[model samples]
Each structure stands twice: as structure tokens, then as C-alpha cells.
Target: MRTVFVQIGEIMTRTPVLVAGAGLSGLSTAVFLGMHGTPALVVERHESTSTHPKARGQQTHTMEALRLVGLEDAFVAASPKSRGFALRIAASASGPVFHEILHDTFVPMGHLSPAASADASQEAAERLLLGRARELGADVRFSTELVSFEQDSDGVTAVLRDLRTGEESTVEAEYLVGADGHRSPVRTALGIGTHGSGSIAHNVLWGIRADLGHVVGEEQVLYYLQNPELSGGTGVLVSTDDADRFVVGVGFDPDTQHLDDFTPERAVEQIRIATGVPDLEVEILDRAPVETGMYVADRFSSGRAHLVGDAAHTMPPQGGMGGNTAILDGFYLAWKLAAVLRGEAGPGLLDSHDAERRPVGEWIATNQYRNAMVRTGARYDGPPPVEDPATLFFGYRHNGAVVSEPGDEHELLEDPNAPTGRPGSRAPHVVLDSPDGPLSTIELFGREFVVLTGSEEWERAAKSVAADLGVRLTAHRIGDGLTGPWAEPYGVSDDGAVLVRPDRFIAWRSPGPGPATDLERALRSVLAR
Candidate 1:
């Protein structure tokens, strides 16, 4: 059968997916879909990827998601050589020996994942993702914009305009993803509302190029230079790709400070004052005319169109959760979309995307807001002292309809340090010796449901069930392949089985031995058979 549709007399170009925006989230979504052979068309208003060095934190969980699709190496190679992040609380960059707050080396908590958290400017990361998307046969069109879209039960029809030629066209797509940044037109058209601390505070960002080698005696990714004595101002001097390039951040008061007056000369003065480099003269590369805020949409989807990235949630730059979380959003939803398109899952499976990611988005927004509060010295009245960052990163669960009914009321988050193979939680990583070489359990996921058991009998049963379903499911016997205490972390017995989703989140589990029919029944329910 032909993989397209027709409307009236026009032969409408039918695509599996339509991605609005060519930024990081949108590009990543296209790349993931293209890799899975799901044709996608991505439209962006901008002529090219961003050159502004905005977000710089690539968290561990985000890296793991990228690694799943063979894109980790590119990120690592482009990211800054930041071993770990440190909040260097100093009187000034050139002076002072105040208390420097440093944390443990950045790694996924409990060694739960094989991928490492990284540091790279958002601009750099986007360039990499955009290339990969185009390489994977994605139809990415720059200087193009999605004017509007009409969603029906079967597909979405989006109006497109070529910004360069004033040409207009209509495209039919199975689904639409609005990866557009904040102030998303798609979300606005869908009438999605956002809630949370609206405008927390205002901060001005200025990019600069200078020699701060002497000022920064030690190598640090971020420097919170607090110099109250300076007549200019104090904020942060963030390292970008090299020592010469940095983005200068400072509080902006619209009432007193006029953006037009804060020119390159003024920015240079602030940089000099903040760094305590008396005669430091630096070029002000660029500055943001607007400010940043924190918020999450009340709804993730409106009919056949769904929002991702800044369209779904906007958070502070703290914890570097902005871009990282957006990337994860694409990774989480990509495989589900592919599965549904391939008819392996019912359309109901798509509902799991919002059920799983919305809460996580809200949580990240809240935490980042709190982190912003602490940074700006604002009174934070939320969770006292803040929850562990680990729980914020790797601990989120998909409490949605895609998984089987939980045996118990599992928490919204699992402890990354001591992961239990519980429903909704991410599957723990363990390395095993395969004929090709050593491979991580995480490496086994991404493309299909994985049923891992310690007992050979359970493994055979899992294989039989998968064969009957004719789904992209597989089984593995960890103990037989020779491994560590694999079953313990999963809270499974020799005969117990753990059913993992394609996204690496647990779908169901048998704490101990159970009948083979029980496994089959659970699988059928989760798959919506």
C-alpha cells in the first residue's frame, strides 16, 4: 500500500511527523524519528541554528538518552572539559580566598547510568543535533515557519510559509510536535495555559571575549563573582568553549537600568569591575534584550498536536536543566511515536507521553525556580533545603497507562542510589560479557521492550511471549551470561522477571517466581492488546 494520502484534487504530502522549530528539542526529535525510519519534516523560522551561547549544562540523564541513538560521542567531543561544576564564591575573580563551594565529580547518582553529564553551550549542541538530523534523512527546512495547524482524529494539517520566497503550502502529518521555544505560537494556538512562578526575576546576559587567565587562577566552568565593592555590578562570568569567551550575567532592574544605555563600553566596565581586573578591556559580543522566567504548561498536548521543550516547560538556567530536559523530552517520546506508527502500540500509548513527562517538567521548573531563588538571595518557601538532585534527575517515573497496574503505590520518583526494579522507574544499568565484547544493560534497551530474568526458565518464557505478540521485544538471562549481583538492584529473584519499556523505564515486574501466563497477561495489558 502507498504510504500517503490524498485530499480533493491535490496530492497532499503525508509525513509521519511534523516538527515545528529547528532548535535543540525540535532537531533532536527529528533526528530520533529519522533514525527509526519515521519520516519527519521540521520547520524553523530562523535561517540557521543559534549562535548564542545560552544553556551550558548537559545532565547525565540527558546524555544517556542521546547515547541510546548513537549520538553521545558527538556531544562529548563538543562539550567543554568540565570535570565537575563548582560554585566558586570569591570576593572577586582577581582577588580573594573566600569559601569555594564544590560538589562531587558530576556522575549519574548511584552509578545508575553509563553516560556522563557534560557541559556545552546550547549553540554548540544545536549545531551537532541539526547535522545529525539532516544526516538521518530528516527534511529540515530553515527560513520556513508553521503558520497554523488544524488537528483531526487521524492527522494534523499544518500551514507552512517559506520566509524567503513568500511561498505557502499545506502538509498532512500523522502527528505534530511543537518544539518551538517559549512564547510558542503552536501552544498559543492550541490554547494551552502555563502556570507557576511567572516572572521570578530579571537578569541581563552579555557575551564577552577577553583574557581572564590570570583572573581565574583555577579552571572552573562557572564563576559566581561577588564583588559588592565594585561600582559597576557583580554576577557570573561563565566559561563557554574557550578561556577567551564567556557570557557575563548580571541582575537587571528595568526601573533604573535602561537596556539601550547598557552598551558595549558599559558591559566592559562591569566585566572589569566584577573580575577585579583593573584595566581589563573586553569586547561585548552580544546581550539578551529580554529576561528569563520559569513556567510549565498546564497541558502537554491538545488533540493530535503535542508540545515539547520550551513549549511544554521553561525553567531557569540553574542545574543546567533547560536544554538537557528538553533533549530528554524528545528521546522519551520518539520511540513511542515510532511504535504507534508501526502499529506495535495503540494510539492510547501516546497518552503516556504527557502522563509521564508533564509532572517531571513541573518538578524541574520548580527546582530550577528554587535554585534561582537561592542564587539571587530571594526567600525560597518551597521544600525546605531542597530535595536531592539525584531524585530530580534519574528518579522520575512514567506513571501512565503504557505500563501494567502497579503491585503497589510506588512513589513518583525512585532513589537513584538504590534503584528497585519497580514499575515506572528507569531500568538499572549492568554490564555483561557478550560475544561481541562487554555491553551495558542500558545498551540493550532503546529499540524494544526487554525482559530480563535471572532464571533460564523465565527467560525462555519471555521469549515465547514476545514471539506470540510479534512486537519488538526480547529477553536476556543475566546470570547465565556471567554478571554482577544483577537481580538484587532490580529486586527480582532467580525466577522473577523485569519488563522494561523501549524508553528503558520499567513497565512491570515479578518480584519472585510467577506463572508464565502471568507474564503474558501483564504484557498484553501494558501493550493495550
Candidate 2:
């Protein structure tokens, strides 16, 4: 409902937000910004969306975020329905399975949230996001690059070049988002430093056409082939959305061999050996070398410029967290930037981006790097224990944009199953019966700040505060038109209240009805007003 479509100007250039790189993060930032009534100008150096089935699998947390922009159905329909994912230690798809590291089922998480997890490929996901972003009035241009940008207290001035015409233009924006890839020119211009394990391995990614469904099964498959006969001692094979298409990553030492050394013929032979099937018909569609590494930027924002996705953090794609995290980074920034641009929040609210996302990014990068090392037999201190998937998915907490109770210890993560509804935590999902139909409480956020209460007085206070502050805010009574058992899950009583941010994170909570000034104070603090 917060979606506000502005008329597209023929020669328009200025925007409130200028997003660089049309990857998942940049596109998502543009899409979410539009949803919050602040469409962005998105530019990408590449000519078009990626054709490669690069990253796959959208976790529950990501699905929830995508649902905010009504992308859940499209994404779920685009991907394959899977019982879950399977990671096995084997020579190849056709070879004997040496060990099974993880075999998960997707059905168990049905009650945790309203959105369904998806195995959608990055290629499909990007197309959907681009379409939605444009429909919401975003001006997304391809073959355009962000040449440089300078930011002062008021706004950002950026130079952009058309890759095709080689003509350059200047644009002004209230804020700039650097969603570029790992080698980010925007980040470089910002002088942002990175810290973590650098380039762990060099791998040649090969696109192959083969009927591996019979060998790999229908579920998502991750085959870790430890065959010394391959170029490197190890190799990885993953299944894509297409039944007959697959991606094979073969590692190689840059010191001895190069990407050029792995010719089409050599690649076929290597795939044959890894599959343990001699004379297997295989056609190489494409091949490119990629370097895997672990790194996190020291800062996520600088002045009016900010970083997201690989520009902010880079980690091995062992768990597909990088792509999901990148999308989330965009989601997190969109709302805050929208609020600041609209004068609903102070500029100081933007500073919270680094405090909220950097720690979570570091944890994910470090753990994923450790996981990659173990899977590849690379040296590490030891194989660190992986946190529960649910914890990693929904349990991560935030430190910014929240007014916590005085005694709150501020744990980074909590058991989502035993959600306490503390400030900075994700709002727990609860089924609510309404005139339309049954809906999860998760469906109630994203457009504007929301206050939930069963008390009429609190609802009145919420409405008064919104008018007094001149900000977009909504109040919903639990038992009025909506009937449900939400008080327990929200950690509030019948007369208590819960404040949820636009991103659906709990910003504050009260155990019982409070003075009229209570809700106003909480909103002011959360908005950095």
C-alpha cells in the first residue's frame, strides 16, 4: 500500500537513491525503495541480467523479505519444488556416495513463517526483481556504469557513463548505494577497507548439458568430488533448475595451471572422470574462472554512499548465503533510506546500517569461509560447528532502530522457535483470522511503521503520534477485525503494545498500557528523530 508510482520523465536523471550494479542487491534496493514510495535510478555496467544459474536457493528469511514486495509467488513458481537439499561426499553425480553431510526437508519450516523457501536460480530471480522494480517506477538502465561519486552532508553527485555510446552524464541523488560485485569501484572510491581470508581457491565454472536427474535425483544436490584425477584434488557439481543442465566447478592451482589450460576437450574429460562414467556424453556450454574468498568491508556506509551485497561482504557460495544476504542487505537499506529521504527519520538513522548489518555479515562470511575450507580440504584452525539453519535464517538480531528494555543483554541470535519478541528481533509469525481470509502476522508489515495492540487507547495513541510526527504509521487491533492468539507471541498483554519497523523487526514493546507519551518516545528513538 506504500507503493507510490511517479510519472517517468523522458529525460529524467535525478533521483532520491542511485543504486549501482543491477545484481540481486542493487535490483532489490531499487524494488524496495519503490515500494516505500522512493523509486531509485539503478545502473549496471553489464548489458543485461545474468544468464548463468549462478546462485540458487532462497532461504526462509529471504523469502519473507521478497514476500514484502509480493515476489513470493513468482519466485516460488520459477524454482523447483524440492523435498530439500542434499550434500554428499562423492566422486561425482554417477559415482558412489562416500558420505552424506546433510539431507534436509523443506516441509518442517512450514509453521515458522508465511513465505515458502525457494530454490530459484539467480537468473530467474533477477528477471522477476527487474520486472517488479520497473513496474514500481524504478528507472533501471543497463550498459550504464557509475563512473564516480562525491557526497557531502546534503546529497551525492555522481558521474555515469553509457557503455555503448561512451557518452557520460552527471546525476544528483540524496543517497548512493554500491551494490557492485566483489571488485567494486564505488567501494574503492570510498576508501573502504576489507578484512578476512583472501582468495582461498581458484575454480573454473563449467556449464554442461547432461541428463543427470537420473543420477543425482530430483532434490537439490551438492556433490563434493574428491577425485585426485581431476585438475585439483577436489571438485564440486551442483544441479540447476533445468533438468538437463548442471554446473561443475573444478579447482586449479594458478601457479601450475590456468583457465586456458582447461579446454573444452579437457573439461569434458574431467567431467567424465569426476562422474566415474567413461564415455558419458557431455557438451560444454560455457566456462569461466571464479575466485572464492572471504572478506567483509570495514564499513557499510560513508556519508551519503552505502555498500551492499558482494561490495559489503564476500564469502564462499557453499550455502548460497551470499546471494540471500545480498538481497537482505538491499531490503534493510531501502526502508531506512526511504524514511530519511521523506523526512520521516533523521539522517542519523542511516548510520545504523553499518551497526545492524556488518556484524551479521562478518559472522556469515567467517563461518562460510570455514565451511568452504573444510569442504575443499583447505587448511583451517579446525572444522567449526555450523549454527542451526533456523538460527542463521531468522535468529540474527539487530542493534539499531530499536528501544530495548534496560536489562536486555543484547544477544546476537536467539532461538526463533522460542521467540521472545524482544526489541531488535524479528516479529514472530502468528495466524490471524480476518474478513478476507486467514493470514500470517508477517503479512502486515513493509509499507510503513506498524503498531499492534488490543487496547483501543493504544491504537488512538498510535494514530495521534503518526499525525503529530507527520510520518506514515498504521495501527491494528488484535481482536477488532482480526482475531488471533497474538499477544503471547508478541510478548504483550491484551492492553500492551508492539511496534514493528517497516522491515518487520520489532522496534519496541510494552507489557501493558502506558502513558500517551510512551509510544511517541519509542517511535522518536527508533527513527533517530
Most accurate candidate by lDDT: 2
Q: When superposed on Cα atoms, how far off is each prediction in RMSD?
A: 2.9, 2.7
lDDT of 1 by residue, 403-452 (tens): 44546574577677778777888888776777777777887787778888
- Kindly list the per-residue Cα lDDT of model 2 for residues 1-529, writing each as its tens digit: 1222333453336788889999999999999988888888899999999899888878888998898889999998998766578888887777777888778744356677878888889999999999999999899999998888898977888888999999888777888999999998999999999999888888888898987766777787888888888877789898787877888888888898878898778999898877667887998998888888988999999998999999999999876688899999989999999899888999889999999999989988888887887776666787584657787788889988899898888878888989899999999988899999998888888778999899999999999999999989999998899999999988889899999999989999998999769999999998999
How many clashes (backbone atoms < 3 Å, residues ≥3 apart in a chain or on different chains) does model 2 have?
0
Every candidate's lDDT: 0.77, 0.87
Residue 171 error, candidate 1, Å: 1.2
Worst ten in a row by lDDT for model 1? 1-10
The TM-score values for the models, in the order shown, are 0.91, 0.95
lDDT (Cα, 0-100) at 29 in candidate 2: 93
Q: For every model in order, what is the number of clashing pairs?
A: 0, 0
